[model samples]
Target chain A: MNNNEKDKKSLIDDYKLHITILFISTISLGIGTINIPLINGFNLVLLPIMYSLFLAVLFYIYKPAKWINKSQSKTCAEILLILISPLIVKLAIASGENIDILFNVGPALLLKELGTVGTVIIGLPIALLLGFKREAIGMTSSICREPQLAVLIDKYGFDSDEVKGFFVVYLIGIVLGTIFISILTNILCYLVPLHPYSYALASGIGSTSMNVAAVSSLIALYPALSDKLLALSGLSNMISVVFSIYVYIFISLPLTEKLYEKFHKYFN
Target chain B: MEIDLSFKMVSEWIGILLIFSVMAAIGNYVGYQYPFVESLIGMFILCLISLVGLIVEKLLPFDNIPAIIYISLIGLFVALPWFPLADLIIYYTSKVDLISLTTVLLAYAGVAMGKDLGSFKKVGLRGIIVTFAVIFGTYLGSAVIAHIALAYTGMI
Candidate 1:
């Protein structure tokens, strides 16, 4: 390949690495957000924003040359920031109290709480729906990029009729799965007396990132359960990550390929 | 007086939609390229949407005031009914939360996106059937495994 082409490829690789790092950071923040106290009703919503902003700042400052550069500087910087931001915010509040600023801010707390409730109820779902759809589109685009997977999709011979059929089956599977898991978790919770928070944690194992959001929001609303929720979520997240890896490597891809070969004629 | 829906809300929603779409598209692509990134990508997409909503609200016209109002409303709705639904099911049944359910749904999406039917190939029917089967089977397997584990440990 020409030098220009090589340079372009390298740049793309770097971009991919940055994207991956950003992706992982977002997931981690989601995990962290679940445990944040819901003082004045702040929870998953604000916590993630705080964490992501920290990440963005770090990204901007370090501007790592490679994706996997394990520089302690960046890690230390992040740790310091996470520790400091809350302390600063808390200190400010304390100082405000001494100066009588607390009184002025105190009433605003009610407004903030009301506002939080409103946003959580009305805005989050719309965001989630749009988010999921967008993620779906993102998934589609990503799939198109993979030669092997793309070839497999093309071989499946997607058509309007087939797409509709697939959509139906897909929806059915989702509904059934949801019902089944819900029942199963319910039974477990009843017998074990697992807290609702614990149930959320376990449920999160299937999808770490999504679960992080669920767990964080729950923690934010109910700070009393924060520690237990965090522990459970952490455990569940580890298990989910392991399981996800296993499924992807051993089951999902191979079975998909095999099935594709076996049933190609049926789809057409 | 009724509060007007500010440009911030509209922008936030649109930003959310765009981010989500990007995430979804990226996820689909990444799953095809590296299946391992599936759940990670899925979560990232969700986070990006939320972030977009939060950021755009700050940057755009509605400012923090209307944005906060919009977000708080959304958060409450999601947490309230959804949490209870999961709780109610767990209250009476042996199952847990909806993780497995969502996973199966995602897996189906992954599979549908992953498959490649040759020209003149009949993937439509087969893909549908297989996707359903896979989702159901995975859900059942996960639930059984979780239930059995909990039972064995005397947790359930």
Candidate 2:
């Protein structure tokens, strides 16, 4: 390669990742802005995404070296979630008088056989069919998230055999689940005929970061449903947290074992 | 990574405080109810509570409790109208603008994914497929049940 060409390629090699991130964020922000109208004689609607897009460019350009690792990214994500936690609090507090919604919403979420419970019911059979071993079944069925880990440790002690699979799934959930859930839910919104409330409820799959990402996209599509969606998501999340303890103790743990005994042979 | 109990850490903290101050000042012009001065105080309170929550979370005899839930539950109670300074907290937090939060967050997520491309590739095609398959089944199960209930209740 010529000297000038070599210099250009070297610069690209040095900073390609940041450039790629900036490009992706910019394109996504641009695509998201397509149908935005000039609300109040100005495009105020695009401001948030634009600001976010700007932050992306600025951060990529500056490159926060401290935040380049997996753990640091997770910490930053936790901090961001903390900043956004008030939304949940506000929604819960706003829906305080209408505690009826909790009664009304709780059954739908719990009964649907989804969330953590449904994760096992639906995912176990499929994972088994896919030749998944019993070792991974514990992790595969449940969300294998933070709360589950805590419960697992408390119930069986940290040294229990189940803890091994939970840790693997937990790692996968952190690294892949956090990002994929957002993208997947958005795609599901388009695929399913259900209302945004259902999507919001689904968003509350017991992971705060994923829930935020899912609800954000859903809200973008149906801005009018923001409050209801947020309320349902928050309430559902609260229910998940409060009841997940019982669900695991009574349902998920046993079911995983039963399903494994019944199906692990088929996989082999 | 052991955080040094030294002047450097102190200096870093001071720098972060200043950045939040500037961000809040700019937030005033960009959004509603997020007053420049109020935002500074608001962010300070958020950081303080989060720090406390982290300590409490670490001391708790459990694993895998994300600090977000700890702080959110606590923040929820603190945000009740009956709580002192609740109105001020609402005024500041309500202006956080979810869209803005999402944009910045998802952007971070996107970049994190980009940075982790090597590891993702290592997980190979099977990992990606299983992840999607699990997610798909979960959504289908949830949506199917939620749809029936909503239909029965006529909330659809």
- Which of the numbered candidates is closest to the native, going by highest lDDT? 2
Runs of candidate 1 with Cα error greater than 4 angstroms are A1-201, A206-209, A213-230, B1-141
Candidate 2 lDDT score at position A102: 54
- How many steric clashes does model 1 contain? 76
A40-114: candidate 1 lDDT, tens digit per residue: 343323223234333443443455434333332222222221121111111122222233322332322111111
DockQ of each: 0.03, 0.25
Model 1 residue B124 CA deviation (Å) reads 17
Residue B14's C-alpha lDDT in candidate 1?
A: 44
Docking class of 2: acceptable
iRMS of candidate 1, Å = 21.2
Candidate 2: stretches off by over 4 Å: A1-106, A109-116, A124-268, B1-41, B58-69, B105-115, B122-128, B147-156
